[model samples]
Target: MALPESARLEGPILQELLALGGEERLRVLYRRLLAYFPHLDESERDCASARWRTLVQRAGARLVKKGELRREAGRWALTERGRQRAEAEKMLVEPPPEESPRRALSHEELQAMLVEIGRLLGKHAEREHERYDVVWKDSPLSPRLSHVFEVQVHGKLESALAKLKHAYDTQRSKPVLVVSDARDERRAREWLRPYFSGSFHEIG
Candidate 1:
């Protein structure tokens, strides 16, 4: 039987998991998707389960005996035949052509682009500052495409305190940053008094 369009997408999706070494990593990938796309209702998301089963069954039939794919633990890897078929399918696929590319810009042109971007950001910051006194800085965490986390620094204690409180209350996790100076840290602790009543540490 011919594979469905969903099955085709699922084949690559499962292959991506297998290439990452199976279920241990796959579960992490799944969770990251959930965290990033919170709009998805897990209970209503039958696509994942259905696609997973279809990919396993179809790919498994061509590679391993019936039931082999479903029986694996820790990692769900592709059988030899499955791997070959996946490779063949990938070879047959082609990406859509690029829409258009603006003429390559010179150094001066690039600098002009940067200036425009900075102006836009400045306008945005001014608008934001009018509504909220909080100022944010980037976190030390390395950006990962697969991670579902956002980290930021707040200039004032109240903003940081509010975020910290919300994180705990919502059962969500986020990293907050405070100044390295002892005096500033003390002040932050005092401001956070109402919301965060527990011990907090400052890391350089």
Candidate 2:
């Protein structure tokens, strides 16, 4: 079967979820799948779309046929063989950093810079907080957090964006992702394509 971009991504996504979570309901698994591949467009992102849903179902069906996965009653899971395959699959890991002539900021230093920027703006600034790497509040006395910052160094880009999205949804604070290099910035921008509504911002 011809696999489109969504189908291509769904195969590995389903395998990863099944290996990690065991049996998963299709709806919930699909939600996580969308999160993992944020470059998907509108029609592909719509869970209610039959065509999109079929792509996921087809991926599962192929895996089941390969004796790597099983599906029953709207739930999908990996077989023992599938678990091995998933474990064997090479992860999408970040490549080793190239040597730079200029000194680079450490992750903590990046967070500190964000906090310092907030302080200079006269906002209450803090770092290493739960939910965000750095946060800026309206004032020293006010409890309102006005901005949330996440610094991505060599960690999973999706995990960082997930936290930023959560912060935006819960507090309506402006979410910013700070990357260590231009390569990471490009990756972050590609992921934010799904957020055409402009829910996230990237800072170098």
Choose the strongest candidate by lDDT. Answer: 2
TM-score of each: 0.26, 0.43
* Candidate models: Cα lDDT each: 0.39, 0.71
Compared with the true structure, what per-residue lDDT tens digits does model 1 show for residues 104-176?
Answer: 4443443344334434554211112222222222232422111111122325554544544444344333433
Q: Name the lDDT of candidate 1.
A: 0.39
Q: By summed lDDT, which 10 consecutive residues of candidate 2 come out lowest?
A: 90-99
CA lDDT, candidate 2, residue 114: 89
- TM-score for predicted model 2 compared with the true structure: 0.43
- Tens digits of per-residue lDDT, candidate 2, 107-174, equal 98998888888888888999977768998989877666688888988788778877877877777778
Worst 10 residues of 1 by lDDT: 142-151
Clashes of 1: 0
